[model samples]
Target: MKQDVDSAKAVMRELFAPTPLQHNLFLSDKYGARIFLKREDLSPVRSYKIRGAFNFFRKALAADDPAERFVCASAGNHAQGFAFVCRHFKKPGVVFMPVTTPPQKIDKTKAFGGDFIDVRLHGDIFDECYAAAKAHSKETGALMVPPFDHPDIIEGQATVAAEILDQLPGDANPDLFIIPVGGGGLSAGMTGYLGGRIGNESFVFCEPEGAPSLKESLTAGKRIKLDQVDNFVDGAAVAEIGSRNFDALKSFAADQVMLIAENAVCVTISELLNVEGVVLEPAGALAIAALEEMDRQSIAGKTVIVIVSGGNFDFERLPDVKERAMRHSGLKKYFILRMAQRPGALRDFLNMLGPEDDIARFEYLKKSARNFGSVLIGIETKRPENFDALTGAFDDAGLRYEDITDNEVLASLII
Candidate 1:
C-alpha cells in the first residue's frame, strides 16, 4: 500500500506539480487554531478527480491490451478528469452523462478531450447514465473506469495524503484532519494512508446531510443504497457508498463522521467566496462546515488540515446558493399570515415589523372572507434575532400566522 501510494505521488508529478498547502488565516483566526487548507481545487482539472482518472487509464494502457478503449459515467468533475486523461493518453473514450447535466460542464469535458472522446447524453438520472456506460463497455470490450471504487483509483487518490505529509513542516503533523466524503474515494484514500502513517492522528469525515450514504452504511455495517438523494450538492450527492471504499472506511468509529445540512453548507460556500475570495463547490465546503461541529477546546491549539475538495461551482446556481444560505442563516423567512381585510390592515402589519426587518416578498394567497384574508409574506432582517422581536409585535397586535421557514414540505410547495 505504501509503495502504491508513493508510486502514485511520483506519477502525479508527471501530470502536474503538487497542489499547494497554504495556512488559512481566516479559518485559523475564526477557530482559534492553526488551519491549513489542502488546495486540491487548484489541480489541473480544478479538482482531485484527475488523479484517479489518470491512474486508472495509466494502468489499463499498460495491460495486455493497451489499445483497449475506456468509458465512464459522470456529469461534473469526474467527466472533466476522464476527458483530460483520455486526451493525455491519446486513447479513445466515451463519457455518459445525464441529459440534465449543465451545458458548461458538457462543453468543458468536450474541450478537455478534444478528438479523443465521445460524449453521450444518456438518461435523466445518474443511474441511467451509469447503466449505459456499463453496457457499452461490456458490449465493446472497453474498460469501465469507475469513479471511486477500484484499487488503483483508491491508491491514486491516496497520493493527496502522501503529498500533505511531505509538504507540511517536519514538526507540523496535523493533529486533526477533516475530509469530505462523496463516493468515498478521497476520504477512504486519505484515511487509509494517514491511518498507516500516524498511529494516533484524528480524522473527521464530512458528508452532505441530504446524501448520508456513508453514515447510513456505517450504521448498517455494510453498504446501503438510499431510495432518494437530494442532488442539490451535485458534486457530493451520491445515493450509495462505494463498496470497495466502504471496506476501507467501515472500521472507523461511527461518531467520527459528521453530516452537514446542504443549506448550512451553502453559507460556508458564500462566506469563503466573499471573505477569502475562494470559490468552492458544495462538496468543497464540507470540511470547513465540519469545523463548526467540532469540540473547539480539543482543537484550540492543535494543527488541523481541511481538504478543499473541488472548485467546479457553476455561477448559474449563485441565486439558489444565496437563497439557501439566507434561509440557513435565519436572515430570511417565509410565513403565511391571516390578516384583517380592512384598508388599514396592511399598514398595521407593516407597522408590526421591527426596525431591522424588511419585506422581500408579499403576495395575497386568498381573499375569500369578508373581514379576513390570507397573505404569503417573505421577510429579511439584519439579524436572526430580529425575527423574534417582529413575532412578539405580531403577538401583541393579534396577528395570526404560521412560520414555515423550516417546514420542508410546506416550503417546497408554497415558498
Candidate 2:
C-alpha cells in the first residue's frame, strides 16, 4: 500500500505539489496541545480530491484499453476534481450534479473542466444523480469515476498520509489524528497507509451528526444506509459509506467515530473565517470542530493533527453560516409569543429584555384576534443566560410565549 501511495504521490507531483502541514498557533494555544493542520484546501483544486481523480485518470489512461470518455456524479468537490483532471488529460467527460446543487459549485466545476467536460443537472439528491451517471456510463460505454469507492481512488487519497508523515516537523509522530469522514475515502486511505506506521488508537474519525453512516455501519457490523440525511453539511452529508471504503473502516469500533452537529460545524467555519482568515466549507471544518468535543484532559499535552479537507466555500452563504453559528453558541434564539394587539405591547416586551438583549427578528403571524396576536420573535444577546432573566420578566408580566428556538419542527416551519 505504501509503495502504491508513493507511486501515486509521484503521479500527483506531475500536477501539483504536496499540500502543506503547518502548526496552528491559535488552535494549539486554545487546546494547550501542539495542533497541526494538513492544509488540503491549498491543493490546486482547493481540496484533497484532486489527488484521487488524478490517480484514477492516470491509471485508466495507461491501461491497455483506455476509456475514451469519463463520467462522474458529484454536487461539489469531487465533480470539480474530476473536471480538473479531465481538462488536464484532454479527455471528454460528463459530470452529473443534483438539480439543487449550488450555482457556485456548478460554475466552478464547469470552469475547471473548460471545454473538456459537460455538466448535467440530474436528480434532487446525490443518489439519484449517481444512478443517472451510472446509467449514462453504461449506455455510452464511458468509464465511471466514482467519488470514493474504487481502489485506485483509495490509493490516490493515501498520498495525503504520505505527505503528512514526510512533512511533520522534526519527523515527530502525532499522538492523535482527527480525520473527517464523508464517503470514507480519505479516512480509509489514510488509515490504510498508516497501517504499519501509526496505531489505530491514534485516529479519530468525525462525521456530521445528521449523517452517521460510518458509525451506524460499524455498529451493525456491516454497511447501513441512512433513511434520511441533513444536507446542511453538504460535503460530508453522505447517506451511506461506500462499500469498499466501509470494508477498510469496518475494523474500527463504532465508539471511535464522533458525530458533530451541523450547527457546531457552522460555528467552526465562522470562527476560522473571522479569527484566522481561513475559509473552510463545513466538511473541511469537521476535524477542527471535533477538537472542541474531545476531552481536554486527554488531548491537553498531546500532539494532534487535523485535516482541513477543503476550502470551496461560497461567500454568498456567509449570512446563513453566521446565523447557524450564533444559534449553536446560544447567542440567538427564536420564540413564539402571544401578545396583545393593542398599541405599546411590543414596547412593553422590549422593556422587559435585558440591556444586552436585542431583537433580531419580530413578525406578527397575521393571525390577530380582536385582543391578541401570535408573534414570531428572534432575539440576540451577548450572553446566553440573559434569556433566563428576560423570560422570568416575561413570566412576571403574565406574557404567554413559547421558546421555539430548540424546537426543530417549529423552527423549520416558522423560524
Candidate 3:
C-alpha cells in the first residue's frame, strides 16, 4: 500500500509539488502541544481532492480498454479537482454540480478544466445532482469518477499520509493526528496506510455536528444513510460514509470521532483568517476546530498534526461566516422586542444598550399593532458577558424582548 501511494505521489509530482507541512505557532501555544498543519489547502486545486481524482484517472487510463471519457458530481472542491485532472490528462469529461452551488465554485471548476470538461448545473441538492451524473455515465458509458468510495481514489488519498511520514522533521514522531471526515476518503486512506504502522490511539476523527454519518455508522456497526443533512459545511456534509471507505474505518470505536458544531467551525475559520491570515473553508478548519473540544492535559507536550483539507472559500460568503462566528462566540445576537407604539419608545430601548453594545439590525416587524409592535433587533457587543449587563438593563427598563440568537428556525426566517 505504501509503495502504491509512493507511485501515486510520483505521478502527482508532474502536476504539483507536495503541499507544505508547517508547524503552527499560534495553535501550538494555545493548545500546549507541538502542532503541525498538513497544508493540503495549498494544493494546485486548493484541496487534496485533486489527489484522488488524478490517481483514479491515471489508473483507469492505464487499464485495457479504458473509457474514452469521465463523469463526476460535486458541488465544490471535488468538482474543481476532477476538472483539473481532466484538463491535465487532456481527457474529455463532464461535471455535474448542484444548481445552488456558489458561482465562485462553478467558475473555478470551469476555469480548471478549460476545454476538457463541460459543467452541467443540475438539481438543487448534491444527491439529486449526483443522480444526474450517474444517469449520464450510464447512457454514454463514460467512467464514473466518484469523489470517494473507490479503491483507486482511496489509494490516491493515502499519498497524503505517505507524504506526512516523509516530511516530519528529524525523525520526530507525532503523538496525535486530527483528520476531518466527509465521505471518509482522507480518513480511510490515512488509516489504511498508517493503521498498523502507527497505533490507532494516535488518530482523532472530526465531523460536522450537523452531519455525523461516520460516527453514527460506527455506532451502528454498519453504514447508515442519514435522512437529512445540513449543507452549511458543504465540504464535509455527507449523508452517508462511502461503503469502501467505511471498511477502512469500521474498526475504530464511535467515541473516537468528535462532532464539531458548524458555527464553532465558523469561529475557527474566522480566527485563522483574522489572526493567522490563513483562509480555510469550513471543512478545512474542522481538524483545528476540534482542538477546542479536547482536554489540554491530554495533548500537553505531545506532537499533533492537523490536516487542513482545503481553502477554496468564496469571499462572498465572508459576511455569513462572520455572522455565524459572532453568534457562536456570543458576541452577536438577534432578538424580537415588543416596542410600545408611542413616542420615545425607540429612545428608551436605545438607552438600555451598554456603551460597548451596538445595534447591527433593527426593523419594525409589526407596526400595525395597536399598542405594541414587534421589533426585530440585532446587537453586537465586544464580550460575551456584556450581554448579561444589557439584558439586565432591558429587564430593569421593562422592555419586552426574546433572544432569538440560538433559535435556529427564527434566526433563519428573520435574521
Candidate 4:
C-alpha cells in the first residue's frame, strides 16, 4: 500500500466521482450501531467491478503499446465495467459472454461500450466463455483485461478503501468493515489496504452460501474450486476465489469470512427497498444480511461500514426476488395436499385456511386415485405466524399435506 493505493486513488479522479460513503440512519438505528454503506452501487457501472477494469486499462495501456486492444470475458457486471472502460479509453474492446446471459445485461454492455467494443456471446458458463476470450485475444494480439486476478486490478479495487478512509466523516475509523466476496477482488484489495492500516480482525468477508469459494478456500488453506455453483446471486456467484485475491486474503483465519444464504440475501434486498427505498442487487445485500448472523451484543455499539457492492438490478427479476423474500420470511408456502374425492372436499380445504391466508395457486397434480387426489397449493399470508395456525387447523381436520416450501425438488417443479 506504500503510495501505490494513493496513486490509484489519484488516477481514479479522472474517472467518475468517488461513490458515496453515506451513513444509513435506518440501518444504524436498527443495529444500535453506526452503519455506513460504501455505495459502489452508485458507480457508473453500478458496481465496484469498474474500478478493477478501468485500472487494468489504465496500467496496461501505459506499460504496453497503447494501440493494443482490450479483451475480457464476463456475463454481467464485469462485462458492463469493461465495456465502459473501453469507451473511456477510446480503445477497441472485445468482450466474450455466455450465450445464456440475459438480454438485459447484453444490451447494457453494448450500450456502455457503444462504438468501442465488439461483444461475442459464446459458451454456456463463465469458464468456457473465458477460454474463448483468451483464444480471441491470442488470435488478435489483444491485451486481456482480467476481471479480478491481476495486481493492477487489485490495486484498482484498493482505491475504494482509500476513498473510505478519506470519506469517513471525521478522523474516525469503523470498528468493523464488512465486504461482500465473489472473485475476492474487492475483499482482497480492501483487506490489503486496511489490514496494515486498521488491522485484519476489523474486516469481515461475506460470500454466498451456495458458492462459498472464498470461505472454503481459506478453510482448506488452498484454492478450492467448486464443481457446482448456484448462480442465483449471479453478481457474487463465483465458483473459485481468484488466486491473487486469495494470496492477499489468506492471512486471515477461515472464520473471518461468512457464508450468506441466497434467500436471506433476497430478504435483505426486499427490506432495504421497502424500508429505506434502497434498491440493491443480491450481492449488494450480502454485507447487510451478514449482520443478522453476527452476535448482536458484540456489535451493538460498534461502528460498521458495509460495501453495498452493486445495484445493477434488472426489474425483470423482481418477481423471483420477491418470491425468495416471501419464502425466507415464511409468509408464503407451497404444499401438496391429499384431499378426499367427496363433493365437499374442496370447500373443507378452503375452510381450514385462516382469514389472512389466500390461496395463490391450486391445481390437481394427480386425480387418478379413487380415494384421494394430490392437490398442489400455494398460499400467501399477511404474517408468517398465520401459517402455523393454518397448519394446526389442517392437522385438527385430519387433512394430510406435505409441506413443500423448503423442498427443492418440489419447489423447482411447482414454485
Candidate 5:
C-alpha cells in the first residue's frame, strides 16, 4: 500500500501538483462545524479523474510488453483524463462517447490529447458506447483503460486519500469524509486507502437517487446492472457500480450510503454557484447535499471533508439547473388543473394566488370540444407551506387539480 501510494505521488508530480485542500469558511459557519473541501475541481482536468488515468498509463507503460494503444468510453471528465494521459505517455487512444454527448465535452477531450486521441461518437447511450469501446479494444488489440473497476485505476485514485492525510494539519484525519460515487473508482480508492490507515473515521457515500448503482449493488450483494438510468447528473449516473469498486464498498452498512434526489442535487449546485461563485457539476454537488441528511449531532464539532469532484459545468443549462433547484426546494410545483371555459374562470384562479405565489408557467394542454380545459400550471412560491394554502384555495373555488410533481412518467413528458 505504501509503495503504491509513493508510485502514484511520483507519477502525479510529473503532471501537476496536488489539488488544494482548502477550509471552507462559509460552509463551516453555515453547518456550525469545521468544513474542508478537497478541491479536485482544481486538477488539470478539473477533476480527480486524472489521478487514476495517469496511474493506469504509468503502470501500463512500465510493463515489459505494453500495449501501444489505449481505449476508453466516457463523455465526461474520465474521457478527458484518459485522453490527457494517453498523450502524456505518447500512446494512441480511442475514446468512444455516446453521440448525445455535449459538444463541449468532445472538444475538451480532443484539446487535452491533441493528436494522440481519437474521439468516436458512437451510440445514443453510455452502455452502447461502452460495448463499442470494448469490442474495438478486442479487435484492435489495444488495452482497455477502464474508467474504474481496474486495480491500477483504484490504486491511482487512492492517492487522493493519501493527499488528504498529508494536507491535514499534523496528519489530523477528518472525523467524517463525504464522497460521491459513480462507477465507484473515487469512493473505492479513498475507502481502501483510508479504511486501512484510519479504521475509525466515518465515511458517507453519496449517489444520485435516480441512479443508485452503488446502493443497489450493495443491497443485492452483487453488482446488478440497472435497466434504466437518469443521466441528469451525468458524472455519477452510472447504471452499475464497477465490480472491483463494489468489492471494496460492499462491506459498508447500508445506512452509510445516501441516495440524493437528482433535483435535490441541483439545489446544491445552484447554492454553491450563487453563493461561493463555485461551479459544481451535479455529481460534484453530491457530497455537499449529503450534509443535509446527516445527523447534526454527529457532525456538530467534527472536522468534515467533502470531495467536490468536478466543476466542468455547462452554463448553457443554467435555466434547467434553476428549474430543478426550485422544484427540489419546494419553491416550484406542477399541476394539471381542470378549469372551466368561462370568461371569468382564469381571472378567479389568478386572484386565488397568495401574496408570495407566482405563476411561472400556464399552458392549455387541451380545450377542443370540451367544457373544461386541461391546464398545465406551474407555480413558484416563497415557501413550501404556500402550496397548502394554494390547495385550500383550489378546493374553495371548486377547481379540480392533480399534482403531477411526483409522477415520473407524467412529469417527464410535460413538466
Candidate 6:
C-alpha cells in the first residue's frame, strides 16, 4: 500500500506540487497546542479529489485502451476534479450533476475540462444524478468513476499522507491528526499510512452533524445508511460511508469521530476569512472546527495537524454564511410578535430594545383582526445578554412575542 502511494505521489509531482504544511499561530495560542494545517485547499483543483480522479484515470487507462471514455457523477469538488483529469489526459468524459447544483460549480467544471468533457444536468440531488450517470455509462460502455468506494481511489488519496510525512520537519511527528470525512476517501487513505508510521498516534475524524454516517456505522458494528441527510454542508454530506473506507477505518472506536454543526462550520469559515484572509469551503474548515470541540486539557502541549480540505468557495454565498455564523454565535435571532395594528406599535417596540440592539428585519406578516397584527422581526445585538434585557423590556411593555430562533419548522417557513 505504501509503495503504491509512493508511486502515486511520483505521478502527482509530474502534474502538480504537493500542498503546503504550515503552522497556525492564532489556533495554537487559543488551544495552547502547536497546530499545523495541511492545505489541500491549495491544490490546482482546490481540493484533494483530483488526486483520486487522476489516479483512477491513469490506472484505468494503463489497464485498457487510452481511447476509452470516462464518466462520473458529482455536484461538488469531485465534478471539478474529474473534469480537470479528463483535460489532463485529453480523454473524452461525461459529468452528471444535479439540476439544482449552483451555477458557479457548473461553470468551474466546464472551465476545467474545456472541450474534453460533456456535462449533463440530471435529477435534483446527487443520488438521483448518480443513478442517471450509471445508466448512461451502461448504455454507452464508458468507464464509471466513483466519487469514493474503490481501492484505486483510496490508494490515490493515500498520496496525501505520504507527502505530509515527507514535508514535515525532521523528527516533528504530530501527536494528533484532525481529519475531515465526506465520502471517506481522504481519511481512509491517510489513516492507513499513518497507523503504521506513527503507530498509535491519536486521530480525530470530523463530519457534518446532520450526516454522521461513519460515526453511526462504527457504533453499530456495520455499515448504516441515513434515511435523510442535510445538504447544507454539501461537500461532506454523504448518506453512507463507503464499504472500502469503512474497512480501513472500522478499527477506531465511535468516540473518535466528532460531528460539527452546519452553523458552527459557517463560523469557522467566516473567522478564517476575516482574520487570516484564508478562504475555505465548509467541508474544508471541518478539521479546524474540531479543534473547538476537543478536550483542550488533553491536547495542551501536544503537536496537532488539521487538514484544510478545499477552498473552492463561492463569494456569492458570503451573505448566507454570515447570517448562519451570526445565528450560531447568538448575535442574531428571529421572532414572531403580536402587536397592535396602530402606527405607534412599532415605535413602542423599538423603544423597548436595548441601545446595542438593532433591527435586522421587520415585516408585517398579516393582521389577525382589526386591532392586532402578526409581524416577523429579526434582531442583531453586540452580546447575547442584551437579549435578556430586551425581552424583559418587552414583557414590561406587555408586548406579545414568540422566540422562534430554535424552532426549525417555524423558522424554516418564515425566516
Error of 3 at 261 (Å): 0.7
lDDT of 2 by residue, 86-147 (tens): 99999999999999998989999999999999999999978799899999999999999989
Clashing pairs in 3: none
Query: lDDT by residue for model 1 over 1-415, one digit each (tens)?
Result: 8888888789878789999998999999999899999998999898999999998888887878674698999999999999999999888999999999989999999999999989999999888999999999989988898999988898888889999988898878688888998899988888888886665338888888998899899888989899899888788899998989999999877777898999988999999999999999898888898888788898898899999989989999999899889999999999899988888888888888888889988988886789888899999998999998988988888889999989999888877
Clashing pairs in 6: none
lDDT of 5: 0.89
Please give, for residues 1-415, the per-residue lDDT of candidate 5 as tens digits: 6678767887689898999998998888888888999999889999989999999888888899977999999999999999988888888999999999989999999999999999999999888999999999999999999889999899998898888888988645578899999999998888888876555348888999889888888787888898888888889998888888888888887778899988888899999988999988888899999887777888887899999999889989899999989988989999999999988989999999999999999999996935899999999999999999999999998889999877879987988
Number of the predicted model whose lDDT against the real structure is largest: 3
Better of 2 and 6 by lDDT: 2
Clashing pairs in 5: none
- Candidate 4 per-residue lDDT, tens place, 1-415, comes to 7488888788888889999999998988888889899999999999999998988888888884574688999998899999999999899999999999989999999999999989998898888999999998889899888888898899899989999988998855689999999998998888888776778889899989999998889889999999999998888999988999999989988999899989999999999999989999999999999998898897898889999999989989899999998999899999899999999889988888888999989999997999999999999999999998999999999999999999888799777
Two-way lDDT contest, 4 vs 5, winner: 4
Output the TM-score of candidate 4.
0.98
Q: Mind sharing the TM-score for model 2?
A: 0.98
lDDT against the true structure, per candidate, is: 0.89, 0.93, 0.94, 0.90, 0.89, 0.90
Model 1 TM-score (2 dp): 0.97
For model 1, the run of ten residues with the poorest summed lDDT: 194-203
- Model 5: CA > 4 A from native: none
